[model samples]
Structure formats: C-alpha cells, structure tokens
Target chain A: MEQEMVLKNENSLSSSLKQMLLKLTPSIKKDGIIKSLKNTGITLLSILMFIGLWQMGSKALYNKEADYRIEKALTERGEEAAAAERACIESGDSSCQPNTLPSPSQVWASLQSLIADHNLIGAKKNAFAKKMAATNEKMIAEGKDPIVYTGRASFVDIVLTSIKTVFAGFLLAMFIAVPIGIIIGLSPSLRSAFNWFIQIFKPVSPVVWYLLVFMIVKTLYIGDSSDNAFVISFISVGLCAMWATLVNTAMGVASVDKDYINVAKVLKLGTFQKVFKVILPSSLPLIFTGLRITLSVAWMVLIAIELLAQSQGLGLFVWEEFQNGANDSNSKIIVAMFVIGIIGFLLDRLMLAVQNMVSFNKNEMA
Target chain B: MAYLELNNIYKTYGEGENSTEVLSNINLTMEEGEFVAIVGFTGSGKTTLVNLINGLLQPTSGEVLFKGVPVTDTSHERGVIFQNYSLLPWLTVGQNIYMAVKEAFPKESKKVLMERVKEYVGMVNLSPAINKRPKELSGGMRQRVAVARALAMNPEMIIMDEPLGALDALTRGNLQDEILNIWSQDKRTALLITNDVDEGIYMADRIIPLKPGPNATLGPEFKINIERPRDKTAMNDNPEYKKTRNAIIEYLMDIGDERKTVSDVEYKLPELTPKSFVA
Candidate 1:
C-alpha cells in the first residue's frame, strides 16, 4: 500500500509540473536565469575582493590613528616627568617646569580651530580678485611711471595665476610640438637635420629655460605687462617638454612595419590615404605613449618653471605654502603636498585609462 | 612576346671591390595561366628571382618584364605570399582578405565586396577563423589566411615564395593539395619558389631548377605533362614524374657541391674603393 501510494504521489507531482509548464508558456527560461545569476554572483565576489584588498592596503600604508597613539605615549611620559620635577622643585631642582609634547586631542583641536577660522572659500576668491586688480593697477601705474607694491597678494591669488600661466604654456607647447614632431618623424631628411637640435634641447632643464625666457621677456617688454611673464613661463615649459612628443611621433612613424607600407603600395593607396589610414593607425600606440609621457613631463616642468619664474600655478601654490610654513603655519605645506600628490595620481590614472582604450590589445595596460 | 619575361637578368649586391653577383644571366618566359615551379638548393637565389618578378627588388642589370614592360616596384597585378605567412597581426582573417578585395575592386558595392571576401575565405576552409587575428591562429591557419588574402584580390598571377615551407609534412601536403585545387579552378599564372622537388613535380606544369650561387641562374625547365588531379600516392609511379624529380634533385645536389668550395678561388677587387677613400 505504501509503495502504491508513493507511485501515485510521483505521478501526481509529474502531472502537476507539466500543468504548471503549460500554464506559464512565455515565462523566463530557467537556464538563462541561472546563467545571469551566476554572472551577477561572480561580479559581486570580484568587487568584494577588490574592496577588501584595497582596505587592507590602505590600512597598511596609512596610519590614521597614529597621532593619538604617539600623543598618549608622550603624555604618559610627560606626566611621569612632571610629577618627578614637582617633587624635585619642592627640594630645589632645576628643569622643574612641566614640558610635554602636545596631546593628540590638542593637535586635533588646533586643526579644527584653524579650519574654522580659515574662511577658505572667501579668502581664495578675495585673493584672486586682488591679484587681478593688482595686475591691472600695476599695468596702469607702469604707463610712464613705476608701480609700487602696496601689500603682498595672498597664497590663493599666487596659485591661481600660476595655474593660468602653466595651462597657457602647455597649450602653446602642445600646438607647436605635435605637428613639428609628426613632420620630423615622417620625413627622413627633416629628421636628420633636426636630430641634432632635438638631442641638444630635449634634456635642458625647465629652470634654465625659465631664466633665459625671463631675461628675454624683460629685455623685450619695458612695461609691467603680465603678458610678458605669462609668455616667459609658456616658453620655458614648451622648450623643456616639446621633445617628448616630437621624438615619439618620429619614432612611431619610422617604426611602422614595412609590410603595411607594401600593402599600401599594392592597394595603390595615395600618400594622404596611406598616412591617415596605415601609418597613423599603426603608429598610434607609440605616439600615444609619447604624448602621455610628454603631458606628464610638461605638467611637472610647468610647475618647476612657474616656481623659478615666479609665475602662477600649483608650483607657485606650493612655493607660497612653503613660505607660509616658514613664516608661521607649518601643516599647510603638508596639506598642499598631499593634494598635489593626489591630483598627479588621478592625472596619471586618467592617461593610463585612455591608453588602454586606444590600444589594439584590450588586455594591455600601456 | 610571352605574357611576362625576364631577359638576361642580373642582381648584384654592393659595388666595385665588394661586389657580389646574386643572379646572373637569368632568362625566363611565362605564358598566360602557366604554373611554374622553381626549385633550388638553399641560397640558390630562388627568393631573389621571385622578388624581382614581384617587383620587390630590381635586377642590378637586365630586365624583368610584365607582358612587355619592365617590372618596377610593387604592383597588385602580381600577388605574393611569403614563407613566414606575413599577415598583419592586428587585423582579423577577414580584414586581411578584405583589404586586398577592397583594393582589387574599389568600385564594387560593399555588399558584393563582402560576399567575395566570404567566398574566398571559405575557399581556404577558414570561414571559422574569419574574425580571429593572425596571432591567435596556427601557422597553417595563418598561411590559409595569407592565401585567402592573395587569392581574394583575383590577381592575374600569384607568386609564392616557399609559402608552405614552414609547415610540418602533413600540413604541407594538405596545403599543397589545397593550393593545387585552387590553381586548377582558376588557373591563375602561378610561380612557386620551392626547395621541395616532389612539391614542384606535383603542382607545376613546368619545373625549373635554380642553380646555387655566388650567382644563381635557371638551369633548364622540365615540362610535366601529367594529367590533371594527379594523385600524390600514385605520382611516384609515373615515369615522367620520377624522371623530372630526379633531374631537379641531381641539379640541386651539384649546385650545393659547387657552392661548398666557391670561396676558395675568389681573388678580384676593383679600384673604386681606393678612389672613394682618397676623395
């Protein structure tokens, strides 16, 4: 009877399953759902693993709570010393006054108070306005007369000016460098003639370029025109950084395989077509590599040039931070350094991402 | 005049004191749709001869003519397939063939061009690897793509510089049959540069042995009048096949012997080197 009942139940279950399948005629397929679910699970696991690893690395690299630990230790030591000194002073001891390292709480409170009092947004805007006004005022005063400095511009104003100058310089460098580089690379005769020039100028420092350009600007422009300063800074960065793109373009053009050229020949491809299609695409990887390196170098050299030339940008910002630290506040320079590092890292990553996208091999990182 | 001819061709490297002749007094004639195989010992200047024909190189003296005109630089009319299977690594099998097809028929509709590509790719039995790059394919597979690339253009003649030399015996034999089948269908004027005597005997209507060199020259042409669709296993049994194959092997062996001791007797230098140095 139990066996018969089991048979009957199995039959009923199979029939019920068939009926359900018939009723749900257009329902989602089981296999597709399972496949999608599996993929989602995999993606989630990978993301989790990445996050976990990143957290571990961050913890290893950064000591967020280190100040507290160090301060607690110093405080304990300072208190012990202070108690001993008190006892000694009662019996007449030298060095009896309590001298202790500031506690973690004290440092934190100091930082908080500084942040609260900074008026950072207003100060930056005011500095920018004042610098612009000063430049205008200086230009007006320099019209048949010398201008005098009423007061110093704030750090924010100095940084804004520096950034504006570097960007202008960088743009000029890019425009001049890319076309000349392409022409040099494509033509053997041109490359040969310019090879010596490239070798001579490619390695010169930005500081030297800035100094030379500064002298040229002063000699050329008698008035207190900010344009002269901007021009000097641009020339400094452009001269220092143009070689990277130029050499890369030339090397890229030269390194394009002979086979593709032959293919172009067989196809009866015109000069423009060959260059645009076969040569350009083939050389793109190397050219992009050069451009990426050149941009980074230009960014770095622009900063150096600005620092040397006393032009506006992050380099000047850093310089001002240093000056401020020397004068009164110390940690502003540290904050600025960290900010620069983070920005540079982001820029490098953006270039890397772009390189990956442009590369023929998707798996390749550079 | 024959469809194409090389008359008293000479290709020499360097000049004056350091001059070395690579091909000397080479002459050949090919009628339309003729299949010729040139076999030689290693360093027999067979590749140089084919390069001259393909217009990849110019003969230092004499003339290489396509129909009646001198061969100059590279042209699409004579398609070449190299031994190393030079397919652009960046492009897929389809793209490689498509490049040639597009070149050949610039005015053809894109749809028709695509169809021709598919047909030719299928001709080499590589439709599956159409989307796959050269790097991802096997050596045999890459050569198939190369053949597809050349044949898809429908050139008037095909020049192969040891196209199957790199493959193993089995793959080589398979490609040889495939090449023959393709040749039989269209009968494009074909010149194969090979060292394999049997391969030459099996494929070509005429086999010419390139004598080994300080300067290599074509020895004599052996005409193979064997019936079409020749069986590889039974080819050995044919007297004509055996005779021609032995003759080529003997000629190559003699050339190899001659090349072995060629350096011992060399003794001339020209005066230009001294003059140039003085100036």
Candidate 2:
C-alpha cells in the first residue's frame, strides 16, 4: 500500500515537471535562445582562435637581427654601461628596433594610455574652464573682453571632430544630391545634359578634389586656422562623396515601378504629392544604400584629406603617430586602425537599420 | 447622352514606318449605372481600350468623353483595379485604402476618414487583414484590398483591367460575388475587361467581344437579361445563359480560325542573295 502511494506521488511529480517544460518550451521557441547561443559560442571561439594565433606568431617572429645587435653590444661594452641599453630594449621601448612589431598586449596598453590621456585632458580642460570663468567674471566687471583657452585636442576630441566632419560632409552631400537627382531623374533632357558632368566627376580622385577645394577655401579664408582646415577638408569630402548618392538616387528614381506612376496619375495626385508619396518611399532603399557607400567613402578619404589639410581629427592623429616614429606610436596607430574599422562597421549597421525601417522589401534586409 | 463614351477611337503604337495600329474604330458607350464587360482573347487590345477609357492614353484619332466632357487625363472620378493588384507593397491594406480615401475627401476630419477606411475594409470582409502589408497577404487578399481602395474613393466610374485573372478559381468566384454585392448597393458605373466569357456574363449587364488585333475592334454586344442576385447553379439550366455562351464561343472561334489562316500566309522566306565571286 505504501509503495503504491509512493508511485502515485512520483507520477504526479513527473506530470508537473512535464507541464512546466511545456510552458517553458514556447518561450524558448519565441526567443530563439538556442540559435542565438550557438551564434555567440561560434563568434567567441573564432575570436579566441584569432588572438591565440596572433600571440604565437608574434613570439615566433621576434626580430633576430635586433637581438644579435643587443648581444654584440653587451659583450663589447661593460655590464654597467650596457645595463641602460638592455633596460630600454627589455621595457618594450618605442625607440628600439626589436619593439617595432608590437604584440596585442602592447596595443592594449597603448589603448589604455590613450584613454588615460583623454581623461587627463578632460580634467585639464575643466580646470581651465573654471579659471576662465573666474577671469571672465572679473573682466566683465572691468568692462573688458575675456581670454579663451586654445589647447591641443585629445584623442577623444579628435575622434569626435572626425565624426562631426564626416556627418557634415554626408549631410551636405544629401542636400545637394537628392533634389538634383530627382530633377534629373524626372526629365530625360536634364539627365542627358548632366550625364557628361556626372561621368567625368565620378571618377575624379579625392586628392584632386582636395586640391581644388584647398585653392578655393584658401582664397576665401585667407588665414591658417583649424576651422579653415576643417571647412576645406569637409568640402572636399562632400564633393567626392556626393557622386555615389547622386547617381544612386537618380537611378532609383528613374527605375520606379511604372505601375506606381500610373497609380499616381489615376489618383490625380499633384507632382509634389506624387513625388513625396510614391517616388521617395519606393526609392528610399536605394538612396540609403548610396548614402551608406558615400559615408564609408567619406571616412576613407578623411585621413588623406586631414593629412593634407592639417585638420584636428583622428586622421591627423594617425598621420602624426606615423611621423612620430616612437616605439609606442606603432601600437597607438594599430589602436586607431581598429577604432576606424569598428566605427565604419557601426555606421553601416546604423544605415542598414534605418533602411530596414523605411523599406517595404523585407527580403532585402540582410 | 452616355456617361462614358469612346467615339471612333484609333490607337497606334511606335512611330511612322514602324508604327502598328493596335486598336481601330472602337465606338462604345456606357450608361451611368451599367456594368459592361469587354470580353476578348489574349492580344485583343482589351487593355489598350481600358487605358483609353481611363484617360491614361489619348486616342490617335478619336476622343473619350465622360459626362459630355472630353477625357484629357486620368482623374479620381474613374478608379482602376489593375490585374497585378497594385497595392503599395510597403503599405498596410488599411493605409492603402486610406490614401485614396484621403485624396478623395481631403476635407474630411481624421476621425471621419478613419471610419470611412474601416467601413470599406469591412465591406470586403478583410477587416482582420487590414493592418497587414500587401507582401504579407495572399494574391486574392491583395486584390480585395485593391478593390476596397478603389471603391473607398467612391469613384463615379470603376475600371477593372482583368483584376480577377490572376486569382484561383475559388477566390475569383468569391471576389466576383463580393464585387456584385457591393455594386448592388449603389449601382455605380463599372467596366470589366476580361478574357473570361463566363465571368463577363455572370457580372455584367451586357457582354461585348473585342476581335483579335493588330487593329482590333469591338464585335456585337451580347445582353444578359437574367434576374438580379444570380445563382451559379441555376445559371446552368438558364436558356438565355446557354444561348449567349454559344454565340460568344462561335464568334471567338471564327476569329481564331481567321487569325491562324492569316498568320500562315504572312510567313515568307527572304530572297537569297547571289554568292559574291571575290577571290
């Protein structure tokens, strides 16, 4: 009898467990947790493998010539004299030859130092602002103009400046391209008239554009200031990036479905209404794709433009680090490279999200 | 005077030497509340005729008139239901209908507009799928939404360009009934262009055949004098239905044979050039 009772209890427990499992199963299916977990595991494993290979390769490929030179110097000179040179090489000194190809750890340390430098600059700026506030108050009471703090930009500041310039150029490109694209797309005569200009300017190099913009901006500004540098660089970037957006927008507008156009006509929609309601909505996916490409091009051309224009941005930072020729500068440049790649990826993802939101074609989301 | 008139309409495509006349001497008239179906075989310029009536294309020689005024361009007074179910794929069914309704009654309040959209959506029995995008809906559902959108505008005349041609048999029958039910309520002027003679007879007050083209013209009209609220089962036993069907089939067969004979004679071999004797 007792055993029979125990079996009934066990059956009840099993039934409850099954009920709970059934309830949780739908949640798991809805969330796709298993699929996401698999993806995460794969990504982590690949990243780990990449880091492991990089570490092993860097150690195996140590500079033999530099080691030989260090050994020869140690033997030729006394221990006390060579100790300083050994310390410099052993400490991963930037000025030494053996430290040219930095390991991942060195890059990480450089990144940390850059962040630290940014914080230090922020604190300095805060102190300067406090001092300036006090000085300004005093000057105001005395009826005189207050002085401004003109300091060197930090790494974070340079990154912000680059982002700002690219967006400015991108916005400028959008404003110039979309309207002209629509007008050209709508009228065949206008398209033919502008086709020659589009074909010729599309292939022109960003460097040539920079030179042209520099000549124009130099005459306009007539001063050597960072602001002037930014204006010239972004203008060049805008001119170079605008072509893709313009061409894509025109193509998109021109290829709009004939049925939709007929629908607009049948509805007696005005020209403005037709454009905004039908043409723009239908062509948005292509326009966004063009914008994405244009933004990437703008980013790529920024480094060269900044190097030539001497603008205070991440591009300038990279150029400066390359010219610095210090042992740590290489690692810093590597950090900058990673930063640029990650930011580009993020910008593309942002554009994709916007495109998906606006586009009716869900199959093309990827 | 007829509500819609196509007077001696002649339509030609291309230009000069290469031009082919697709439609010729097309004279037809539709009364204010009449449902007329233009039946034809493939390539009969039925679509061209529909386009001309819709004012999407102007005739090369003749004129299209609506309410005694020459039809110069497309207007909201005549709404079209296209074969491809041209609902904006990106928009929900409700939004698609709402766009037309808004255009038609621009001065209506938002609340009133919403009610009108809901009312028309309910008319097609597609209230459940109103918020679904066209891509998400079936072909029949999309066509139903197209019908709702066109009807919601309360157009004075409705032009259907083989709107049911792509649907399955069941869906086609269902939509035909729904369309007829909607028409019974208001008796609005509607023109259906279809290749299906049975569909034409079932829905239209009169059935007209368009002859095979290049330079197709309308043949004799077959009037359907059956009573209202037609029963599909009862149509089989109806004598008038049998007679009309036989007449249209015979006419179409004659044209088909004639076209075959013409094509057989039209094919000819090009003259062979003499071989050149250049060494």
Candidate 3:
C-alpha cells in the first residue's frame, strides 16, 4: 500500500508540471501582446495631441473680435442676399460687403450640404447639371430667381474637373519625364548638352510654364470647340510638372555603382539587359523618391494652372469660392483644400511602400 | 614559352603638363597550370597588373597574352575573383554562381547546369546557404561562395585579387586550404595578388614582389622548392620557408628605405628661407 501511494503521488506531480509548462509558454507570448497594446496607446495619444494643437491654432487666429464680427456680418449678408434675390431686387450694400468674411460655422454648414449633394447625385457632367437644375428650381419655388450670383463654375464641379485634368497631365508628365531623365543621366554627352536646359527650367515657376503652354495651345488650336480649353489646360499643367521627374530620373541612373557596371561586363550581359536588370534595380530608391516628388509637383502645378486660366480643377474651385462670397462656397473650398492635401500625402506614402518592396537591402535605405 | 606574358609594359596616367607614370618597364610571365603569387605594398600597381591581365583595363604599351593571344577585353577563360567579393547582392548564392556557369556553358540543359552548381556549392560546403542572398551570408561565407563561383566555371586561369585579405585570420586560413585543395585537383593557372609573404610561400611555386610606385613593376622572382601540400604549422619551423621569407622581407625593407630616402630629401635640403638669404 505504501509503494502504490508513493508511485501515484509522483505520477500526478509529473503531469501537473507538464501542464504548468504548457501554460507558461502562452504567458510569455501574452507579454508581447501587452507590450504591443501599450505601443498602440502611445501612438493614438500622439495623433490626438497633434489634432488638438491644430484646432487650437486655427481658433486663435480667428479669435479677434473684429475678425469674428466680420465673419458674423458675412453670414448675415449671405442670408440677406438670398432673401432679397427671392424678392427680385438686389440686397444692396449688405449683399456684396468687402469687409465681411464668412464665419467658420457657416462655412462648415455649406461644406456639409455640398458633400451631401455630391454623394447623392455624383460629380458626372450630366448628374452635376441635373443637380444644378434641381437646385435652381428649388430657389424658384422659394420665390427667388437663380441669377448669376457666382458667374464662375460650382465649387464641387470645378474641383472634379481639376482632378481629371491634373491626373491626365500627371500621366503625360511621367511618360516624358522618366525617359528624358534616364537618357540625360546615363549618356555623358546628352547630360552635358541638356544639363543647362534642365537647370534653367527646374526653377522657372509653374505659372510661367502654364502661361507658355496656354499661349502655345491657344495659338495652335483654332478649333471652335469647348473641349479645346480643357486640352490646353492639361498640356500646361503637364509641361510644368515634367521637370521634377526628368531631373530625378537622370540623377538616379547616374548614381548607380561603378562596381555593378563591371560585374555586368564580366558576366558579358547585353546593354539593354544590364540597364534594366542591374542599373535600374540598383537605383530604385532614388528613382522612387524622384517619382514621389514629381507626383506632388504635378498636383501643385495642376491646381495653379486651373486657378490662373480659370480652367477646370480644384484651383478653379478655390477661385470660384472666393468670387461667390457666400458662407457655403468658402467652407466648401476649405474642405477641397483638405482633400487635396490628404490625397497627396497618401500618394507619397504609397510610393514609399513600393520603394521598400523593390529594394535589395531594406535596412541600408531605412 | 610562357602561357601568358607581360613583355616590358609601360602605363602612365595623364599627359603633357600633368603626366604621372604608374608602371615602367614591367616584364612578367605566367606558366600554364602554375599558381603564382605577387606580393606588394598598397598602391604597388598589383591590382592594375591583375586588371590588365584580366582585360578589365589595358596597359599603355605592353601586351598581356593569354594562351599566346593578346587579352583585349573581358573573357570567360580568364576568371577574376575581385577583392570586394563582387557577388551581386540581389542574387542568391546559387543564382550568382549559376550566372557565370550558364555564361561559360550556355548550351547545357538546366538540369545538368544546376547539378554542376550543386556539386561545386557542396565542394565549398555552402550547400546549406545556396538559396540565401549575398547580404544574408557572413563575409567568410561570401568569399567561399565567390571561390565556388569561380571554380564552377572551370576556367583555364583563375586570378584572385587579395581574395582572403578582408577575412578574419581563422576564416582566411580555412579558405586558403580549401582553395589549395581545389587548385591541386585541376592544377589551373592561378595568379594571387597578396601582400602576405608567408601566404605566398605556402601557396605558390614562386613569389614575385611588385615594387612600390610612382613607377611600380615586378621585382626579382623567388622560387619556393618546398614539397607539395604545405603544412602551415610546420611552415615556420622549415628552414627553406624561413630563408625564402627573409629574402623577400629584406627586398621589401630595401624598397621601403628607398621610398623614405625619396620623401626625406626636402627636409634635408639647404635652408632657403628669407633668413638664409639675409645671412
């Protein structure tokens, strides 16, 4: 009986120990889970802090009573103008007051309505026209004529148009920029001959390019068509954005290691194969960086061309908002600007992710 | 007749007002299936001579004949192992070796080619890390991979430019033995560029010192009549090894003294300052 009891005790103790070890293994992994949670909390706190700071700064800038009062007056004037137009007469000094600026709350409401309308009807040519017609009809029902209060295009409509043109221009710019840059960077004689041109054009300002493109397009195309204006604006934006891409490509190709070139030669690799497989892949980091910069410059120049030419795009939307002088239009413009910045940021981040994927040694670049 | 010869070569950089001669009246010959080591100090044009022989660079005057034909450009027959372990970082160990193997034998089927690669990779004892990229391997492993790569091509001649110079002593010793075993099996014409006198004595049938430059060229060659398959532990104890090492050391020391004498001339010059003129 004593031997049996002793054997049973030892067996139970061994089984319990195994169970304990199995439990502890998971507990060690659980520590990592807690550590990651703590990291996440810290990141969230930092983001909240940044947003709080931005809000506080914006409020402080508009804190003065004169500025605050002017914003209030503008809101009141905008409403009065709408009501007076309903009565078929100008609202007089109250409608077109120069000193007044729309309040933030009024602008926010305007932006909300614009977003709701866009989401409901979409930003297509036919849908936008239909939405406008419905809006004009609603004004008539309220006993107001939808006059040429803002002769410029609708804020949302102009933004949509600008986005389309800029993307087309950006694509065109990429095609020309990357190839030219590679050629210039790789060939010594080409680099020497074209380097001066690159330097002269890099800092020449998008507005100047926009103007030159506009004049050239206008003079060249005598076609009596509305489509011609859109084509002209796109060409202008593309030319302005092309420089950043071209220079970057050239630099990337030029910076590939001499050692790699020799390796290619030793392998007896053909010229085209060497370029694509060895040289191009090695210079991916610089090339991707150039692409990111070119994308942002293209977006920026696209808006500038639209604003200057009063052509379609986000630039035109911002310009239209300023002319409209209504609280809603001003707020809509602010929202459009936010959307532009956010999109550009996302595009750059995507390019960076792509760069990380294709690189040979990630740690060296990081 | 020598399999490859550098007949009284001259190489100079720049011209006219800024001319600088790098090598002058250089003459050397490499025999077939011979392991020759050239020991030199830094900037001794050892690498330049190797480059000229490999046809990566051409000499200004003399001819570099390989199998009695002048080497003008890069060729598969004259395989060069660079100092930098110039393996493509993006390519895996097996792939890098396979690239050269494929170029050396393009008509061979993939199966046979890969089998050859596996065999060579196994020889270097790197069959485990065959799929790993260059960056993933340690420095010693990378050098071994380079050795395996060169051997896989089965070139007529293999030129190594300080192949083990960057390695740790233990790794260097291991690779040196491995290289010797491979060289003995085929007796390929091998030229090693090294500054290690002891290493040269152990490996080569003969040692040649590339004298230091402004105008550097090969000095007198020393024959090591030591028996095949040298023992490193016993090398220091051997009288012939000691004598050969001391003779080469003495020659290097003399060259060093000559360089010092050339540099010290300005310091020992008669005073030519304004005070001297006044006196």
Candidate 4:
C-alpha cells in the first residue's frame, strides 16, 4: 500500500506537469507564432551573413585600392614615397582612406555622425526659434510675414521633407490616375484612345518628366519668390509614377467578370451603383496592386526629381554628400541608401496590408 | 398575356461572314405562377436564351415582352441565380444577399433588409456561413449563397441558369428542394435552364428541350404529371415519372444522334491512294 501510494503521487505530479506545459503552449495560435519565430530566426541569420560579406568585401576593396596607390607611388617616385603611403594607410589617416565602398561599421558610424550634426543644427534652430517666437507671434497678429529660420536643413528635416513630397506626389498620382482610369475603364473607346498615350508616357524617363514639370512650373512661378521646387518635384514624381496605376486600373475595370455584370444588370443597378458597388469592389485587388506599384515608383522617382529640382530633401542630402566627397561622405551616402531602401520596403508593406484588407482572395498576392 | 414572353427571338454573335447564329426562333411564354424548365446539352445557347429573357442580352431579331410591353433592359422583377454563382468574392454571404435585397428595395430600412437577408439565408440553410466570404465557402455553399441572394430580392419571377450544375449530386438535390420549397410558397413564375432531364422533370411543371447548336432551337415540350412534394426515392416506383423521364431522354438522344451525323457529314474523307501510281 505504501509503494502504490508513492507511485500514485509521482504519476499525479507528472500529469500535472504535462498539463502545465500544454497550457504554456500557444494552443490554437501555436502555428502562427512558431512560423513567425522561424521566419525571424532565418531573417536574423541572413542579415548577419550579409554584414559579414559586406565587411569582407569592404576590407578586400580597401586593401586592393591601397596596394594600387602604393604601387603607383613606388613606380612614379621611389621606395621612400611607397613606404610613406603605406604608413599613412596603416595609421588609418583620413586622407588615405579608400573612397570606393563603405563598410557596415563605417556606415553605422556615419549615421551617428549625421545624427550628431543634426542635433547641433537642431539646437541652433531651436535657439533661433525661441529668439523669434515673440516677434513671430506679433507678426502673426499683425497679419504679416514672420521671421523664419533660414539656416541649413538638418538630416532629419531633409528626410521629413522627402517623405512629405513623396506623399504629396502619391496623392497627386492617385487623383489623376484613378479618375482617368475609371473613365477609360468605363468606356472601351476611351481605353483604346488612351492606350497609345499611356504606352508612350509609361516609358518616359523621370529626368524628362522633371524637365517637363520644371518648364511648366518655372513659367507659372516666373516672378514669384515662394519656394516652388517642392511643387515641381512632386508634380514630376506624380507624372513619372502615374502610368502603372492608370494601366492597371483600366485593365482591372475592363476585365471584371461578365457574370457579375449580369448580376448588376438583373438587379437594375444604376451606372453609379454598378461601378461603385459591383465594379470597384470586384477590381479592388488589382487596383490596389496598381496603387502599390505607383507608390513605389513615385518613391523611386521622387529622389531624382528632388535632386534635379534642388529641393531640401534626402535626395539633395545624398547629392550634396556626393559632391562633398569628404572622408565620411561615401558612408553618409550609403546610410542614405539604406534609409531609402527601408522606407521603400515599409511603404510597400503598408500597401500590401491595405490591399489584403480590401481584397477577398488572401495569400495569393504575397 | 403571359407574365414573361420571348417572342420570335433570334440571336447571332459577330457580324457579316464571321457571325455565328446562337439561337433561332425561340418563342417561349411563361405564365404567372408557373414553373418551366429548358433542358439542353451544354453549349447549346441555353444561357443565351436565359440572358435574352432576363434582359441581359437583347434578342437579335425579336422583342422580349413582359406584361404586354417590350422588355428593353433588366429589372428587379426577375431575379437571376447565375450558373457560375457570381457571388462577389469580396463580400460575405450575408453581404452578397444584402446587396441584392438593398438594390431591389431601395426604400426599405436597413433593419428590414438585414432581417430579410437573414430569413433568405436561413431558408437556404446557409445561416452558419452567413459571415464567410465566397472563397472561404465550398462550391455548394457558394451556390446556396447565390440562391439566397436571388430569393431574398423577392422578385416577381426567378430565373436560374444551371445554378446547381457545378455542385455534386447530393448538394444539387438539396438545393433543388430548397428552391422548390421557396417557389411553392409564392408560386412565382420561374424559368430554370438546365442540362439534367430528371432534375427538370422533378422541379418544373413543363420541360422543353433546346436542340444542339450552331443554330439551336426549342424542341417539343414534355409536361410533368408528378404530384407536389414528390419523393426522390419513390420517384423510381412512379409510373408517370418513368414515362416522362424516358420520353425526354429518347428525344434528347435522337437530337444528339442528329448532331453527330450532321458534324460527320462535314468531315472530309482523306485520300490514301498513292500519288505516283506505283502500287
């Protein structure tokens, strides 16, 4: 009886432990959690590998460039000059640093430096704002222009400007494309008529669009002193990126299932109801896909337009850094490249999430 | 006057030399509170006929008259259950039905429309899947939603174009009974286009055969004498069921044979004789 009692106690303890583990598990949501965990693990591993490769490549390129520079000095001058160059490189002097590619660590350092620079500029701007705060309020009350900060824009400010311009361009593209797309989609003749126009303009380079927009904007604001580069940049971006949305929307609208159209008809739906209730809902997935592409394209072209228009944006920052050609300038450009890429990815994901929300068929898009 | 009429209808697609005649001389008149079925082979323009009657397609050479007036466009009077179950995939089952109900009764309150949708959805036994999208539902469930959407409109007439063709036999029977039960309630004028003779005989008051295309036309009509609330299991023992079923099958078989011979005549005979005359 004592041995049996001990055995029962042990069994009960083990059973309770098993129950606790079962409770601790994800239960119904176990699959999703485990899947996401596995994905995160793989992503982390891949990112580590990418940094490793980037570091190795950066070292190899630096060494190759250093060796070439030393060899050229030796051939042109003498062994003394080659030794001096080698010592400069070994000492890690900024003057002898390779400018071809920046390592991950260098890019990270440059990001910190840029942040610090932004902080300094931000402090100065704050001081200027405080000094002018009372004067600005008085000017506002008097219905006149206020004293403003005319200092250089910091890195963060530039990024925000770029984002604002891109969003404005995106909105502009949406307004121009969706309505025209719907009109063309509603009529076969209009689609055919616009086909050539869309095809021709779709392939036009962003540079050309920028020039066209500049010509118009320049004429419009010829005598005006207000900033118009933002206007020009957004307009050019919109013109450059609106094609994908227009074409996709037209195709989506035109290719709605005939059966659905019949359903609309049998219900005796009016034209507005037919398009809004039946047609748009049916084609929303494709339309969202078009919008996604348009947004990405707008983002990509926004940089070029801003650069050409000389707007205070990330593009301008990158261009200025490129022209600056300082020791850390290449790394600054690399940092900007990463920021652009990450922002672009997030924008696409934002669109995909919205697309999934509206579309009926899930998992097909991703 | 009939409740719905297809008078001297002729439909052809394309133009000039490219034109193909799809329907020829389709004169069908459906009375109020009547159930009629047009049974035909696949690709014999039965859908076209249904479209013409529903005002989805204009007859190439004739007018579709309803209530003694020419029918030019679609109206809520005729609610259609499409062959492909064209339930918008984006909308849930209730939403799909609600769309039709709302469109049909624009003046109705939202609460009343929701109740009506629920009632019709319950009628089709799809209340369990009322919140599910079309993609989430099975083929049979989708068809049920389509049926609910059409019936929820409370149209004066119901027109179905092979609505259950994609479903399995069991689901088909279930839906047929559900549709018949709802039809008998109001006895609305109904036109059912199908390829199954037994299904036509079981549900419709009269079954008409659409002879095969390229110029398909209606053949003789067979009247069903089966009593209401007919049993599927007992149908085998019924004498009238056997007689009507056999007649329709034989007529369809004869038409199929005729189509085969017509196509065979057009096939060219190959010459196997040696060109060099060396044999």
Best-performing candidate as measured by lDDT: 4
**DockQ result, candidate 1:** 0.29
lDDT of 4 by residue, A236-292 (tens): 999899888898888899999998888888877889999999999888888899999
Better of 1 and 4 by TM-score: 4
DockQ, per model, reads: 0.29, 0.69, 0.48, 0.75
For model 4 chain A, give the 10-residue run with minimal summed lDDT: A1-10
B43-146: candidate 3 lDDT, tens digit per residue: 88888888888888888898888878988998888788888888888889999898878878889999999999999999999999999999999999999998
lDDT of 1 by residue, A99-204 (tens): 2222333334544644554456456656766767867677778784434443444444454565566456656766887778778878899999998988887877
A251: Cα error in model 3, Å = 2.5
User: Residue A8 CA error for candidate 4 (Å)?
Assistant: 26
Residue A141 displacement (Å), model 2:
6.9
Interface RMSD of 1: 2.2
**Residue pairs with clashing backbones, model 2:** A94-A327
Q: Lowest-scoring 10 consecutive residues by lDDT in candidate 4 chain B?
A: B270-279
Error of 2 at A236 (Å): 1.8
Second chain TM-score for model 3:
0.94
Writing each residue's lDDT as its tens digit, candidate 3 over A66-111 gives: 3444456557777665454443322334444323334455456767
Using DockQ as the measure, the top candidate is 4
Off by over 4 Å in 3: A1-111, A122-167, A215-234, A308-312, B109-111, B268-279
